[model samples]
Target chain A: MSDSPITSGMTGKTFRVGDFLLKEWEPGEEERIVAAFNRVFAKADPNFRPRSLDFWRWQYLDNPSGKLLIHAEAPDGSVAAHHGFINQRLLLEGRPSLCGQMVDSMVDPAYRRGLQRVSLSATLSNSFIGHTGGEGARLHAFYWGAPVPVAMRIGKALVQYEVVRTQLKLSCAPAEVRLQGASGISVEEPASFPEDTVEFFRKVAHCYKAIAVRDQPQLDWRFVRHPECRFSIATARLGGELRGYAVYSHGSFDGFEEGLVCDWLVHPDDGAAANALWAWLVEKARASSAERLTAVFPETVPDWIRFQEAGFRAAPTQYPFVARTCVRRFDPPWLRRNWYYTLGDTDLV
Target chain B: MHSRHPPPSRTLAIEIRPLQKGDEASLLEALNAHRGGCVQQGHALSSEELAWFLAHPSGTRTLLAWEEKEIVGHLSAARHTMWMKGRQVLFAELLGGFVAISHRARLGKRGLFARLCREFFSEQGIDGDFIYYGWPTREEWRLGRKLLAYETIRTQVALTLSVGNAAEGLPAEVELMERFDHQARWLWDRCAAKFGASAIRDEGFLNHRFVERPGYDYENFGVRDDDGVLRGYAVFRKGQWGEETKGLICDWLVPTDEPEVGRLLLRALEAHGRTQGVQQLFCLLPEWSPWFDSFQRAGFLATDAERMWIARTSARRFDVFWLRTQWFSTLADTLIV
Candidate 1:
């Protein structure tokens, strides 16, 4: 096999290796890609939960920042490998910017070793990175992913994926808790967020050096409209105004019923709202019969210490968060100290 | 060992040279002068200890940045053999990195510390022989990321537990050792596969780090089966931290999957710590290690005092992400002991 001509595709760079066409994903190809994704992942793991077209469209096309996808088409017209990203709007150092959240990287077992002995997934990544971010290209400043173990190795060796943090889960046994005296704070699970959520998030945005812009649209798209799991949200109101909110989901992992704190957003000074939301989550966890309640937040986040004080002990989890910086301004150390993230920022929730 | 005098025109006539036989006093003076500036405040090493620090049985080197006659900065690299990816790889630990207080004001963007690092890193890159790592304070870590291209492998977290009653219901026999014997080596060889990456904890490294090191004492305990085959080993030091007496587990090595062996070793340490009147016990571990979960299951809790673990590697195979997931280290791999 020999390298062939390079042509422009959707992201503006394409490759032809022997008979295989390394090209950009285009319209009307959703079913083909989703089938390939399910096939590849199922071959890799016996218990991989197959992804659906609804999930693919909701994650990639329906996102506010739009979709970016690449694939390698074998001679038989099957997708031998695929790489994709869903762009996210980020508040970087108080400036709005775009970043890509990589997802659904897959390679068929037969085409695992791609062109020139590099993995196909790596080839797709290289092509994707070449066309995005930096200078006058796409506006993405960086790309991040929570990849599986094998993909992580290939990415580290071939694609320069620097580890941002090994995500540590804070977990404790769920216990009953009673709300304290009249703090004028109320907690409830609302069917939908009010129109003022965007304003509230904007007011709280200054507290973070880097974070995802979690407005009403993003929340609705991520939770209420998600194709699979049902996520419950609890909002804390003071004087009948939204002060904070927390999102949670329940599942049984390894035979232990667990309640996951997917997102927690409250002003560092708003202890009352924070406590009310915490009590609500605890009661919810207990009512749902969850043995353990788990939450993940960077140690640099302001609420990390609060959760620790609230009896959440740092425990080990298998997820490793990694990022590739396409822009020079954001390096690992700076990101380590400044980036605020939660489980909601990832697709795992 | 190599000596380099930077281009006199570019740098301010600074000379970066190797440490010679009679340089201990000058180095100690410079280190102690800026004791609390950026470096850690351990008791200043005596001449003998300094000599030992510079002397690795395999290889060691120290580079000093000099402005005419005064040493302005110092850096040292000592060779370590690590078990990584099912094989032994040569690595170096960078230590005693400091810049003199007087020189800080004059160091522009291209300063003496940067000069020393350039000379050292260029030499290492050209040789491409070993990967180097260091434990930097948060401040130093920020500087290192910019100047030295250091990437973090993991943050060091100390797992602490109130010294309680000895562990019970262990199936393995525990034996206390004055020093690591051949069985320790045998055990390490058998169990090295369990870790994706770790400092080689064979008998020689164990003796050098725990038994024969100066100015500190550590108790070595081994776990054995009914046939007396050593399955694991742990090193403990009774020390003072804050206002309490603590038993610090400096080094631990056991197959992470073998809970019985780990429990037996921990029980021995707890019993020994209890006899020594230790109020609490502490062990520094990377969360990536399954043994970290084991310690947590044994009732250890994570504390807030996390230190940065950074590394610079020229090896193509050992990338930052791979090392972050695979590397297993303890306090013994650091200078804290």
Candidate 2:
């Protein structure tokens, strides 16, 4: 169980932390890593089920964009801490860039007991942050969704993580939402988006300084091939031209039936299309006997006002989106307001 | 105490009294009329639906401002047992407060809201450590603050994130279920200490608040270990938010020490959302929630707007900061949401 050479398909660079060995994850270390995860989290969470090797493989090896996993091992060969990131492709003003999503951060409870000369949490985080843009790693920025206060404190102290914007949860009863007329626009629930709709999203995406690339393949994987949920897509057209599209589903909240509007994209200048698409969803939800409907959008996003116009009331909770960039420095105030984000951009749903 | 104001031109003597049993029909009519004028979409609730509030186990009492036989203004106070500072205390929540459009001008001038506030507060004497509270609209909040001396508690912010392109995959070992089992009873006891002040989430409360709710289908996801022990759980629903389908996680229970349980449940929820084609996921957590890091790591961000949790204590004067820090409130805690 002592620190020994382990076989791995992907060669990873190693670093030293006191008596612990910190390095990128090797292929043969999945079981050991999973064991560490279970040991640290199982008693804390009674419902914690041990992750399967296949799930771990799919997350790290079979992901379309690949991932970066780093683990810290004690002198006796037990995992002390683990930090990893999955690669993501983000379009910044129509230009593609590599982004890293931080995930699966864990620290062994024993090592986390007290502050010492070598802080395991700080060391593990610093190793990943420092190595993000070095050698084989090409992450332009690191982004995280609703990070806990502890992570935010650590991230702010270590890597200058900044809060970008908060996601607002706006809700309303489906029976209470009145649809306003949008002249020359019609809504249709399509099984799959047409080619024109994809092109329309591309055109709309270019209007934002930052947005997820929603081309055909990305859209198909996001809305269609999602592993757990099914979505209904509605497209708005004017004179047979794609103007906007909305994705929604029906479910229950707090024992009450509800309709959720997950993602909505429309031409930047086409207010009518946005209105038409929203109204159509309301009618659809009402017909399905949904008691209420809810949506989450960034406050800075223009869609917030549109949603308010459509009778969505604000819920009392919000999440702050944080990010760390290695390549560029931009005005924080401007980026905070101009960035386009929707519920689709986050993994919470 | 009925305050007889100087009659402004009309001879209509307004009588304010506790709502009686037969007042249900008139109250319903008044509520529907008020809703019809204000609400653009939702229809009036049926008498049966309205009866639930009147017959609530918490004991609902409405103070109706009547002009002769017709109801002019309505305000209801429902009793709720709240866990505060490691103790259970009775509190009253003011809900569905409205003044008829025809009587708005007169009521505003006569200080009808102030009168209602005084009466409601007086009704709960110093004998019980009762707290009067309400989730009023902006205008109503302002009015209540000015007239009732209601202090602002913590403003709850709705955190949201796009589930699109956010990893929807969950670990295979975690089982996501739709209903709660016997193990859930101990969940509140295990986590209650962390929440200094919150609703008593016992088995009965869980069943009453979520399972037995009328006209709603709530899905509960219980996170279990390999041995089928409940570690954490989350209650959520799929609903429409504007034009997109959204998954709303209403109530979440994970031990404070195990923040990862929240993370695991959230990831599993995202996987569930993917199956439903939910474009986004949202949950309402306090600004100072212990699990904020889990939510942040899960990709939820704070929104610019916030909703307030305002209150006024009838027993004594309380510090706003103490109330804010100790109060564990959520959308599910209130009947309005």
Docking class for candidate 1: incorrect
Cα shift from native, residue B77, model 1 (Å): 2.9
Error at A1, model 1, angstroms: 49
| RMSD over all Cα atoms, model 1 | 9.0
Taking the tens digit of each residue's C-alpha lDDT, what string does model 1 give over B30-65? 777666211243576665566556655546667888
| Model 2, residue B266: C-alpha shift (Å) | 40
Ten-residue region with minimum lDDT total, candidate 2 chain A? A1-10
lDDT of 2 at B219: 75
Residue A181 in model 2: lDDT: 72
Model-by-model lDDT, in order? Answer: 0.74, 0.65
* Model 2 regions more than 4 Å off: A1-12, A25-35, A49-66, A74-78, A113-115, A133-138, A148-160, A182-198, A250-258, A283-289, A331-334, B1-337
TM-score of 2: 0.47
Best by DockQ: 1
* DockQ-derived CAPRI band for the predicted complex in model 2: incorrect
